[model samples]
Target chain A: MAFDIFHRHKLTISGTQAQALEMARLRLIWVGMLMMMGYLAIILRMGDLCLLHHKSTAMLMGSGAPAETERPLRASIVDRNGNILAVSLRMASVYADARMVHDPAKLAQELAALLPKQNEADLFKRLSSGKAFVWIQRFITPKQEYAINALGDPAIHFQEEQRRIYPDANLAAQVVGYTDVDSNGIAGIEKFFNKRLAAGGKPLRLTLDVRVQHIMRQDLAAAIKTFHALDGTGLVMDVNTGQIIAMVSLPDFDPNHIGEATNNEKFNRATLADYEMGSTFKTFSIAAGLNSGKVHLSSVFDASHPLHIDQFYIHDFDAKDRPLTIPEIYIYSSNIGTAKMAESLGPDYIRDFYQKLGFMQQAPIEVPERATPLYPSPWREVNTMTAAFGHGIAVSPLHLVRAASAIVNGGILLKPTLVMPDNPDVPPQGTRVISAATSEKMRRLLELVVASGTGAYAWVKGYDVGGKTGTADKNKNGRYENHANISSFLGVFPIWHPRYVVLALLDDPQGTKATHGFSTGGYTAAPVVGDVIARMGPMYGIKPRMYITRDSIEKSMKPYLKEYKEGQALASVSTDH
Target chain B: MRKSTLLWLILTVFCGIALFHTSQKVHDERARLAALNASIAHEKQSIRVLGAEWAYLNNPRRLEMLAKTYLHMAPLSAAQFIRIDDIPLRAAPAAAPAPQTEKIAVKKISPEIQPRKIVALERPVTMKTRKPAPPRIFKKRAAPDGGTATARNFRDVMKSLRLGVE
Candidate 1:
């Protein structure tokens, strides 16, 4: 066989050459083993990262994530038409770490220049206090915040805060109320629904109409100024729904500046203060009599002289001094006649009637500001006589308006609400306080007052306006003041089908030239109610009937007023006397 | 065996490049998503501020003051409102025949009456021609053909309503 170099395995070389080749193969095997071990270690580490350590690695990579936007701390308060009454806005509050601040005096001087409202001395004192942190100023404007930040002081920092803002300001102040610096609601509907507002969802909708509220305020303020009266209160309510459309109590305070408000300005007279509602209570008295079947429109009462009960004398402002029918009594606002009517109804029956009208307790409304009515506790006979003409018992104007609404709104006693119901199509459930027939009769009587009697100034020709005049001598320290009286008019328009009940009251109104030096409800407040009705009529699109004359009113009221013609003859005779 | 090793090395390089590219694209998309979310939050905040400002500007008291200063208008009075039934009906064309004798007398008095009536009729024709021009301009700006058809349909509906009223 020929031994060739190509077939090395078959040909054997001896000694050192063969041994060297074997050593080279052994070293190559060792290096290959080391490379395989390194690859295996890399595979094991990758498996560990993919299985158990992935979450930790991802978190480490995402450590610099962006922050989410924050929502308002409190929800907004809107009117019935979605007009914003109250809202919360984000603001920057400036604070300083006293320990980090190197030049407190220089920073204070700089901050005072930026914030004109903040005093330099006060800022320096707070900044130099050895405390670690101190608030320099709260709720700084955007302009001031930008200027202060330009100072570039690392010691000063900004804290995000929420501040409540009342955009409508003094327009709906009492109803929307104000909040404390810590964003806690302190009064009115804010305090009433604080938890719901703080939870932050949709805006809280109220039953107030901004347009109607403005109208009432403007008219009431004009009347107050003209008569030189103290603070006045006005309200408008839907009789059918018992929703307060507008409420104004002046001297109203701007909710934005709650710190500067006086105690009297904070007092909500519409729902909180109680007053003897004066002759406006006669509407309830007659309604009570009619509902009880004890009094008819044709029933007659003697107003020939002042009634003597205990030591009190109940005298009519314009005494007829003759027998007057129920319609005549209401139209003329005869205190003697109403007292006689209440005398027939008796004390227990009158008290029960008033209690049924929610007059014995606080007015049930959404606001926490309310007052319990003050009536005679013993329910004596004299109390019945006095309460009939709205003299002894005292109730808030809201209570009077709610009760008056029931009397004219088909006799259904509905709870008054400042918050609008969620479903408007569904009418609120109400308790029937009187028969619809009695309400109809009462409507006719109210119309008669505007057509021919003391509430004549409240009449709008086409609106068929009807109401009563009340001039109550406000009781002061248990004694009724002589010249200081609350003159008010409770008005309902289109009395044939009553829609809205508007009341305007002036506290201690003095007589003016425009009112013929007469500060009674008819002279002072009735025209305001009439003007408000006239302006509001076109807004509500209520059709005005040019054909609804006084003749037509008298004809419709003929059946109830059988003695009306006779009473008219007697009235003319008394005027002549 | 060397050829197979070379092919395996090329496949590993391609796989590594693809993995790196995919991860880089995912990282860029995540950053973009965060930016978009931040912008959306900013827009929502701006909308809230604008709504508050709108309510403040549209306050009835402020509007009334502005109207008093700038506008020549008065509050609507009760006398200004009238029932639709109270509107007097248009004089029938048949009543024109009753005026024919007076027209003949006027014609004898002055030939100028004929030209005056012609001018009055021409005024309405000019107005009618001018009315369609504005809608045509609007159509040119909106869509080529669809806007014209819709505008014509709107005009036809308006014309029919006017005829019904007449």
Candidate 2:
């Protein structure tokens, strides 16, 4: 009877419908859970393959191309003298896949607390957003990477990126501007040559000598601080070859931390700021009158008092009581005398001279980022007089160097340059804007200024140096501030041969008790040029010759000058009549 | 049946002769190949010996020492690195002279021939001096003969001393 009952229970047809429905539901739920696990496994394997492989397709990590996962290539930058100036090496940019992020709030808190720089809330917000990828930190330090790696978060990933490093910290900061977080050039020569860097080729070489650059930066920076000055800029150039060996601008930023820098720190004052160059402009004006055959070395112009114009007085810095010879005018830096000399030449000739010197044009270099010189629109009598003493016109230090090089480089004008291998040391394609004779007289007169006049303190013992001291009153609010002067010194070395030209300017240098409470070119910027010349003299093999005799300066002029007997007879009538 | 058996015997003999001739030809080719292999081995041994000699002669340290002592010169100074702009732009650098191929004359010493000997001899001079003061006592002489005969008067002397000396 029990066996028969069990057999009957196995065939209970009335309950089989509800029993079959329950069994099918259980099987369907199990199948759904298995499919979901399989999809999760496949997604994780794909992520592992992509993150581990630094291939081009793995560029989902972002920032230009895929991060260089293994032995990332570095780009090099070299100076003119074949020295390494800056380089970009392989470094890690740590990121995370928020979709793979486990305990997002906890990981973000850990990273934020560890990084010290980023806010925990912001990191938590970005991490919890369930993104495929997000940059937690870029250009992280090696020590920081080790600490983050120790946290051992499987979701966190690292993408190797190139980080720029300037070995010579502040030497050529303005010229070799820094790169961004993703290693893209943003300013200066670095920006100018970014395309060459992206290809991972050899480092782009510039025409800067890191040694000379260091000397300039050190000298200018010390002067900038000593005078309690706002800013400063300095540049040294080869007159014959038109190579910028050294250039520096103060209040410069560290290229490593470029993003945090202000505009003043990033400003390339040497090539960007155009200032009224004061008596430094005399170098060009004298070159004009002498080149136009309107004046000779013995030609006399009166600096007896202020030269009265239409409601304007062109006064001299060191006014002479009577008429002065051309040499005396330069020796004294007589604004009134130079103004008369400019008046005699006429505005058309002066403006043509400026145009020839490239002063009316943009900064002539390959950097592609430079300010054009501010010059008089039409050459007027007032423009001629004011421009004579560096009042009516303003120019960048690069233009000033270019114009000075033209006046002294045997009268052959050459534009300045920054690139090296491509230029191959070719001098600028410039015409003879001045006679060789005028250049020689200008060199002698310049030497006299350093030896006996305003630039007397800038004299180097053995280096036959010549220069002009310019202490121009800065025009702040349409009127000049007497106390706030832009002191600059335009100097050349071995004047008999004229090999190098230097210009150092200090902006708003205040008077100091250390400077006898006087902030002029001689006190503020002249010493910087002198210091650069002293340091670079031996480096360039420009030794103090045993004899830079007067005969040497007098010898080059012999080929083009006549005796002053004719000029002296005319000088009496020149002053009286 | 008799003709079939005779034909079978003749065919077997021809087949045996053919195998013998073919074996002789195969042996000849094997000997030639073995000789060629021996020649190849000889060439390989010669190359190994030459390679050993080259490794002996080419020591990097020695070459570096030689370069330091004689061949290398210091780099030119910036004063030496003149701007192309500074140069007159008229001429290029001078060319080096052509390397000479010197022919060294060898004096062959034949292995089958005897080497020429260099002979150096002292001249024999006999001076008859007056017996300076007769010795108070005459010393006994072992032999008065100062000729080649006396020189060869050891335990085994040659009878024809003149011929031996010559």
Candidate 3:
């Protein structure tokens, strides 16, 4: 029985081994099928890549459009009338990678043909320096860019850069100013408000009217050409608001090409050049005397001869050599009479008046280029005498305009500004420089200067123009040069209630035949003011009173100037020099 | 394997398929959003460029020159304007004519239908008798042509306007 059981067990073991072998054979077939499926997927993928669209993605990427970039925008600058003066344009600049450049000389020669400003030798030196990257040219024209792109140089690249553009060109160059290549403000209102311009949002709106600026510039250039002067400047200020309407300085440069402009072309003479603005100072001195309550329009000052003070003799440009009333002194522009008036008022009172007028310090204007007034260190009688007639003290034409504004615009001294105020209707409560009564009197006096005095040439038929004429000898090395003088006219129009003060200056005007060998303010600058008023008055909406006469203004000052009229008529008939 | 294990396995496969499908959909949406952002940036850049061009085109110097050449107009002057109060009411429009109506044929009407004479209406006697002043003289800014025509064609229209005004 044991032998039989052993044989059965052997048979069972063989049966189990044969069943396990069958299961292993079936599993091997399944594994073979899985391997075959994997191979099928790999072959299908290779076929799809080869037959359908090989390198489709690589081509799409290689010919892709330029990578998107965001460049910071700079703000625009506009005039008071919303005329665009300066703008920033997004421009493409070409640059090069020296490491990637294979043939520096050839590439540089090709680039030089496109960028005419850069020579081939310089470009080759830059490209061969082996630097990582270098700028080739900035703000290239579209045609130049297209030409450069056709070169197909792998190392050459283009980048969008911000470029400052002045659309008005040299219209208001000194005021609107110019910017550097890096889009930074460097002069004029641009320099004054540089950071605000860089942090770009809204445009910088100035208080300038392009039309008015054009008119002023046209008239000023004509006057300069006519008078044969070196240069000229003209400014129009809204006396009530202290807003500069138009400012023009001759020999101005185009802000777009600031690098090519000469230093003289870039100099802003209106606010930077200091001159001893001759008899225009008499207007201030008379106002000072009137405001001090010690002198009246009818008060008389002795001017029998040239008064010798220490080493100086104070005399008129054309001496009357007689005792004269204050009105006569102003109309005749008598230096001796004004000196006597200044002496009577004392140096303290005169200096105080000048300080109140902002003549002792820098002009309070919205420009970076400002000049401090040159005055005597210590107040003396001789300084007061010369300063009374606009000598011994130097101030810019802008300073004279501001001081004249205070004297004419109801005694309120306001800071002149390039930016318009938020509320122009609400009168700015400025520091008081004179009484309203005194201002009224000063208006009449200035009108006298225009009606029958030195500024007779500045008289517009129906605009009630009032002004003073100043012919200042050009000082050279502390000596007054003969035949070279600054002829300036300070004018206030519709003088009954003054609204605008215009200053026209001709620097070193030569004598002309038409002017009869006179290069004085009345001949050169006063006529310019008149022409400007005649044109701009109608444009500015100032009505023309067809029938207004000198009698209308004379009625107001009849109480004080009854005796001075006869003498003024004789003196003003041929008043040009 | 038990039937419950097979059911659990089937449920897990379904969840895996749903998550995979959701992830694919999210990838497609992200790509579309990226394309939209890029297009928006391009549009903004174009807008900035257009704005700059518009400003350049509208520069005052260029506009003034255009006005001078095409519009034939001068800048407004103070003399050309008057106080609003000076513009008197326009004569009450001169009593507009009555609207027309269909009428019987005059030639065919009978003898009893003879036309009656027109009567004029009388205004109120209390009205003032002030005569209107003549219009102020200003240089007419008549367009040379109808604005789209060339400069040489402007004179005929201007002459006709002058004749019409007269």
Best by lDDT: 1
Decreasing lDDT order of the candidates: 1, 3, 2
Query: What digit string (tens of lDDT, one per residue) describes model 2 on residues A1-577?
Result: 5465324456554587767756877898999999999999999888977676657443443333322444434456778655566666556788999998889889988999789889999999989989999999887878889999999998889887767766555667788876776677777877787777766666678888776777788788889888889999999998987889888888887776666778888888889888998888888888899888868887888788887889887786545578887766765677898889998997677777888888787877766469888877766788988887788788899999978987888898886888774755554577787888888878888886675556766666557788888888898867888778889999999787988998899999887786677788876788889878866775677656434433454343343323322212111100100
Candidate 1's residue-wise lDDT over A360-384, tens digit each?
9988899999999999888899898
Pairs clashing within candidate 3:
B144-B154
Model 2, docking class: incorrect
TM-score of chain B of each: 0.49, 0.33, 0.50
The numbered model that scores best in TM-score is 1
TM-score of chain A of 3: 0.85
TM-score, candidate 2, first chain = 0.80
lDDT of each: 0.81, 0.71, 0.80
Ranking by TM-score: 1, 3, 2
Q: What is candidate 2's lDDT per residue for B70-137, written digit by digit as tens?
A: 33232222122222333332122224433331111112222233123212112122223312222123
Error of 2 at A539 (Å): 1.8
lDDT of 3 by residue, B63-107 (tens): 654455444456543344444444433232123443331132333
Chain B TM-score against the true chain B, candidate 3:
0.50
